[model samples]
Target: MRRRRLRALLGAALTAAIAVPLVAVAGDASAATNSFRGVNWADARDNYVNGWVIPSGLTAADSYSTVYTKANGIIAGFQSLLGANTVRLPINPQSVNDTWWASYKGAFDSALAHGMKVIVSYWEADTAKDGYVDDPAAWNTMWDRVTTDYAGNANVYFEPMNEPFGYSLSAWVSLCSTWLSRHANIPRGRVLISGTGYNDNVTGVGAASALSGTLLSLHFYGFWASDTTRAAWTTNLSNRLGSYSSRTVIDEAGSPMTTGLTYTGAANQDGNVFTSYFAATTDLTRARQMGIVYWPGLRTGDTYSITRQSGSGLAVNNASGVAQLRWGWGL
Candidate 1:
């Protein structure tokens, strides 16, 4: 459960470089660039791509290929249905080390082929014994190989791990710093450093000047709060995000999009947590001109998936998620 939330804020980043013309049009602050827009193309039991070894009763030798068709079909919806320019995909360290990445390469290529930037994120090898990304050795090895394969691709981005909240802040940053040193070829701008403590805040991360150039990844969810008022929710997100908006990405902000705009369920039965949080979050991102990625771009079991099965193709799920995201993107 904890692991899934961390990964729910999975890998995603496609920062659009801002090039404001010398002459700025009057009253155009909101027209400023929407840094990056994306979603987490999740992998669960049937579509788990972080498996170090192929699970039993599975058909493919590589992890991602097991769900290739579904992944490809979903990536197809990035442009028209979701109006997103980036996609975040979960990856296993062992798969990259053991050569599954060679076969699994197509899953990423499918997105890049469509001109969609791919943010390759590392989920824990075993969330049970090891926490989300516990083994430094395996992680180092995985990134070494993965970076070598994608060092030159401008469309590909790398995130060390989804959320390293378990480790001390210093230790987590140290690990990331080491990763930066080891993989110098992967541009710092292309790397994403997850904030501490379930990635709820990036203040500390933003202060780490040694880790400059890399983008910050933050996750906001209703479970973290009971306050549904727009002011409270907006303040919480803005305060936690601090001054990182210029280079930060809210890679995961999702609720029961399956239900309509009004949410009434276990997580939000007492309050309109879904609607308020989504609205405030969208407002904050839009105000700051940042970017966001919805959780579970198109995965089973997660209603936050803004994707659905179309006529032999994929489409955004019928819900307020699409509108909320589009609102933030100014689309």
Candidate 2:
């Protein structure tokens, strides 16, 4: 087994320079025009056990081609069931090399054809350095190729990297700066920046001038949270995500869907913790007219995935989970 499970944790391009608190990015008109209900398409090259073990039976032949082909149906389900307009996919460094870019474009094309905005981020499942931006050369190469591929596609968004916890806050922001200047051809509004730390908080980056103009992204899981009350959830939101909701998106928020997603005051594997958290988050996103994307739209052993399917066809697994997503998305 590749132990891909260990790394289980873990937008935009376009036009003008828009001003945000400490950051002023050009062409970030998204602050006024962006709003979406989205989901993450898990299982990129990041592996587990031996090689890449996705929902083992979710596709035919288990090849990269199959994976991308299947993604079409998976994404369609998200649109039909959750009313999702966005789908974030993680790409491994290898996938972006010249050898694989063409293959990966299938998933990208499938998403865009459905009118789904695509947000792609690079991740090193087995990084030599856990918290630092590992494999700088590979990371840059991946972004360079991907940015070039979708440079002007409004539906495609570029997220330089995901969960950049290895670098210090200052170091990370510096990296963001370098990324902006290096890929200047891509507009600021089309990009998305991970917050400080494991993307658990965004207050610092959201306030940094260098990071302005781009949208902000954050991740949430039950393990990352302790607060089970709505009030606490609200306070936490106000502190971490409140400042930039207009240009922020919760690209990864989730909980176990095995129990079927019903949430009530009474505690259950499907209740209290995740329910309260999403409740507050949904309320905030709606109030601020922000974007929201749930984590693991589909992943094996990850109870958080909202859709349950086998071999890439439409086999809806968790109506409870989907229902909550609908509620969160205001469907």
Candidate 3:
């Protein structure tokens, strides 16, 4: 299913490009940061691709080894294509289980070894399980373990949850508050909470006043799946969050669809999508948005994977045209 979805999106992208030439105009290089600009390591249209595990046919050690190789390769490729400085690593607590500490420790070590900043996202049970009613005790316990183990590690950032889909505003506030309270022991200013799904705009940030010591995180993909409902949501979010001085970042963004429905060109309609997102960042430049992490950096046959159509493996392909845009935008 993942593979098929990627193929369809890639087809659409190719069809759109046929009618319009994809050009990446160079932006101001001065905007780059030590993480992205000065060091030329801005945020990336990062692939949520994991390499800590491989297929069943491989031995456990071999699996880790092979996955790490591919993972590092992908990171290098993205840095080259988007001039990105960081990669968001999704860590499933379930996968760690009884060996949670050991698994994550190893994963973090590997990420640091690759010279990439690690954004660790905690995985919770689905909404059907309990909505946002996560066991606060369990969550705190896990964080304690991580902080104690990785104290003073500059390359690590914690994402309390991913998307928080199906969760209400109050539920989100509660979870975020609990997570922030638990971070007293961890290094301050290294944790971030991912915004609500399909509506990462300001309205989605409900408890901005309550959250402390963590940067506000949100995702963007307005061009591909969002509609008027999402637009209104983002507008409300912008208005509500505009007054607050809290730092904000779009940890994730970019369109992975190949449907030819862009904001420019004949079929293009999502052109303003990226520019609008960038405009939102202008207000809080030092807020350190990091950069936009593009999904599916490889054009694999998945809805979110960035694998390409010509079997070009896991590297970013210019054939997508979006890659060029990312580079030009300094993402």
Total clashing pairs for each candidate: 0, 21, 38
lDDT of 2: 0.66
Candidate 2 structure quality by residue, lDDT tens digits, 205-224: 67777877888887655544
Cα-based lDDT at residue 9, candidate 3 = 30
Give the lDDT of residue 2 in candidate 2: 22
Tens-digit lDDT track of model 3 for 1-331: 2322232233223322222211222222123232421111111211221222211112234444554554455555555654555666554334333343443344356547766676666544432222232555665666666666665778777777755654555456567777677666654467665554322533334234565445556544434333334244345335424432244445544443444323222133223554333233322333433444445444334333333422212344334344333442344
Give model 3's TM-score versus the native structure. 0.61
How well does candidate 1 match the true structure, expressed as C-alpha RMSD?
Answer: 7.9
Q: Please give each candidate's TM-score.
A: 0.81, 0.82, 0.61
Indicate which candidate wins on TM-score. 2
Ranking by TM-score: 2, 1, 3
Against the unseen true structure, what C-alpha lDDT does each candidate score?
0.67, 0.66, 0.44
lDDT of 1 by residue, 1-331 (tens): 3445554343212111111112222221122226567877665452334464332222355455544554466677766787888888777766677666766676677778788888888776454423346566777788877888789999888888876656556666778888899998888888888877666677666667667778888888866667767778888788777656777888878777676664322243335776778778887888888878777676655666677666546766654567667777767
Quote the positional error of residue 75 for candidate 2 in Å: 1.8
Give candidate 1's error at residue 323 in angstroms. 1.1
Greater-lDDT candidate between 1 and 2: 1
lDDT of 1 at 167: 56
Which number leads on lDDT? 1
